[model samples]
Target: MRQFYVYILAKHRHGALYVGVTNDLIRRVHEHREGLAPGFTKRYGVKLLVYFEQHATAATAIQREKTMKRWPRAWKIRTIERTNPTWADLYEEICR
Candidate 1:
C-alpha cells in the first residue's frame, strides 16, 4: 500500500519548527538535513526530525499536517513527546 507522512522538524534548541507532508519520509528528511531542499526549513536550519505520523492515504496525511500546523506550541510539543520523549532524531527509528 502507498503511504504518506506528516512530519515535524526542528532546529537545535527548538530554534524553529517546520511541518510538512511527504510520500517518502526518509528522502524528504534527508533533503532537509543535507540542505538540499530549499525554502523555510533550510533558511532556519530545521534539520532534526522530531515527529512524524504515517497514513495509508495522502489525504489523511495532509489533514493531519494541517491540524498540526494549527496546534499551539505546547500542544504540538506534547504530541511530539507522546512518542518521542527526548525529542530525539526519529529519522533512524522510523526509517528502521
Candidate 2:
C-alpha cells in the first residue's frame, strides 16, 4: 500500500506554522528538523511535527496541503490544538 501525508510543522506552541505534503512523513520531517530542507521551514525553525493526516493518494494529500496553507492562522492553530493540545512534537510518536 502507498500513502501520502499532509502535515503541519511549527516553531513552537502557537508559533510559526508550515504546511506540506510528502510520501515519506518521517524522512521529510527529519529533513526539516535537521535544517536540510533549505527554505521557509528551515529559516523559520518550523521543525516540530505538530499535526498530520494520511491520504491514500498524492493528489488528495497535495490538495489538503494547499488548502491548509491558505487557512487562517487561528484556524490552523485550532486544528493543531484539537489533535495535539500541547502542540507536542510528534516525530517520536510517528517513529514508533
Among these predictions, the greatest TM-score belongs to: 2
Query: What TM-score would each prediction reach against the true structure?
Result: 0.92, 0.98
Q: Write the per-residue lDDT of candidate 2 for residues 1-96, one digit (tens) a residue.
A: 999999999999988899999999999999999999999998898999999999999899988998999989999999999999999999999999
Task: Write down the worst ten-residue block by lDDT for model 2.
Answer: 12-21
Residue ranges of candidate 2 with Cα displaced over 4 Å? none
User: Cα deviation of 7 in candidate 1 (Å)?
Assistant: 0.7
**Candidate 1 weakest lDDT stretch, 10 residues:** 10-19
Candidate 2 contains a number of clashing pairs equal to 0
